[model samples]
Target: MTNNLSVVINSDAQQVWTMLREPARIAQWHGWNADDQEAEINEIYFGPNVVEGADHTSLVVDGGDVFTLKPVPTGTEVSVTRAAIDHNSEWAAWDEDITQGWLTFLHQLRFALERHPHGKRRTFFFSVPGTGGSAIENLGLSDVPAPGDPYSLTLPTGEEISGKVWFRSNHQVGLTVHNYAEHGEGLLIVADQPAIADVRPDGGSLAIVSTYDLGAHQLDAIRNYWDKWRAENYPTSDPVH
Candidate 1:
């Protein structure tokens, strides 16, 4: 099957392979920290559900989803091919949402390896139903500059941020902020989810802000600001940490 999501990380295949295999390295790019994060990782990645190739280049997780790595001229090409879903399948209903999630995580992996390979990350996540608009629109990022172009703007919370465009897709955009972490490096990803009829009538929006080596007070302030923003913008949807 064709890859459902793919990214070229600016690192060697062995490095990417290490990240895929080791739990510690996987934590660098996978989901945010939570009370059950380690348990969830073990169950999904190292448990009975995972199958690894002898050469360590391919992995099959949770039955049908496959992760593969190959060396390329630029670096390493990492790809994920999701299991096919039939109408009767349990995942058929949330296929698109799951695809979007893969898209986000793949980019996060690329960012982790390319930008902050060894740094511990602290993330602030916000996912809420769309109110006919998005965080991209609210942040005035509708007319985005080309990737690597520098940008500076003041957030609704009165914080001024300056960064460069990292990447952009049809429904998502990522930016690198210079003032977020101790070493002045961070990533902000904004995604717009389309309405899925009965499943997600109002659609949705997701924002993931990843900071490395950020002070506690600064992180808390950032979280509080976005939390308030989510509440005011989409009061009906419950806030997600």
Candidate 2:
């Protein structure tokens, strides 16, 4: 058996295309959970993660499907035309699972990346699925490691983060994010060590770190600081979005 579906996103063609290729973003719309996302792009030919020096997301399970993606005039054309599906023979039938899941994740990706676009920095967190650590989710301070602390921020990712205005190097800000469950270290794996700038989509210089090279002290600061920043700068996430 085979399956294919598409949804037109209200975003620029380029932005839609970019999200299709990003495993992190793709997993959100396609993976099991919205709060925790992890998927890597891969090549079917060799089951390789990298192809021609670039990476792709793939899920090749026994009796799984291979999905081929492309950008078409209509939208990002995703063809399930490739891959073998065994239904009960190879894998369980998860049609509703696939249809609703991928479409939703793609829509969110369209909204986020299209308007914001790159050249600016953005960060998101993905927790270990079903790991309901109070500190991890920031559900209540009673369970949090350093409640009522400054320079710490809890993110959607499993990474507990923290940052501080460095007293040295002209107050060059520093940050740390910890991915305890280790799903691609949240979004930190992209690019080099956290990039710091005064870019003002969030008003003035809010330090955005790449989370790749963070340690304990740095993670502490992000966890402490996130609420402070959200309280002061932006609105909290929508209950639904």
Q: RMSD for each model, in Å, please?
A: 2.3, 16.7
lDDT of each: 0.81, 0.33
Q: Highest TM-score: which candidate?
A: 1
Best by lDDT: 1
| Superposition TM-score, candidate 2 onto the true structure | 0.31
lDDT of 1 by residue, 17-70 (tens): 888878888877777766777887787678887999998789997646788988
Locate the minimum summed-lDDT window of 10 residues in model 2.
Answer: 187-196
Q: On residues 57-162, what C-alpha lDDT tens digit does candidate 2 reach at each position?
A: 2323222444444555655544332234345642234443343333333433443343233422234322211122222123222222331233465544333554
Supply every candidate's count of residue pairs whose N, Cα or C atoms clash at under 3 angstroms: 0, 29
Runs in model 2 with CA error above 4 Å?
A: 1-4, 10-17, 24-36, 39-84, 115-241
TM-score for each model: 0.91, 0.31
